[model samples]
Target: MTFALVRVRRGDLRLDLESFARYAGVHPDLVRRLVALGLLEPVRERGEWWFGADQLAELARIERLRRGCDLNYAAIGLVLDLLDRIAELEAELRTVRRSRPPTGGAPWTRTDSR
Candidate 1:
């Protein structure tokens, strides 16, 4: 239940649509279709699609969902949302467990031996 921190770089953090597609390990057509389906939104610069490095992870996630499941784009979004909630719940559970005291089965008792 560990989370990886994603760090964004100041400069050279942007990639064009093709580079983004390559970085995501998905097809360009799929990227276009995702944009058309509203599953992804990229910045349009001078008629070119540009994506930030932050989106690389998200795109990879989407690619995994698209390839791993038979779900449509909308369903994929729902699944991602559920997964995020599950992670949050798991973290909270860990915190609660840490705060609780350990319990033993029974207390020790001493009997008179005289």
Candidate 2:
């Protein structure tokens, strides 16, 4: 995850569909397609969909995966899921490592002579 910074207008944490598309530099129809494909989740309010500012990061991630890996939406979804799982596992491993006492030498040591 390299530096990806998104600037949003202050005091506007939610964006309408069109605004969301514009901010992402894409067409609204593409946004709709993403929504249909379950890649983007928007909240329905008053029959209109609103997306959180945080979704910009998700959109960027989707584009990165699509371009970098040349993947379709469905494959992108699977890749994102796997990436998330890997991150979770890494965090868990860090936590476990921190909780355990360090061995005097390597983690694996033979206690029985051959």
Off by over 4 Å in 1: 1-12, 32-50, 105-114
| RMSD vs true structure, all candidates | 9.4, 6.2
lDDT of 2 at 42: 88
Candidate 2 residue lDDT tens string, 22-80: 88888889899989988899878679888887688899999999998899999998898
Q: Predicted candidate 2: what Cα RMSD to the true structure? A: 6.2
Candidate 1 lDDT, tens digit per residue, 87-107?
Answer: 999999999979978644333
Clashes of 1: 0
- Measured by TM-score, how close is model 2 to the native structure? 0.80
Best by lDDT: 2
Q: Could you tell me how far off, in angstroms, the CA of residue 29 lies in candidate 2 after the best superposition? A: 0.8
Tell me, by TM-score, which candidate is best.
Answer: 2
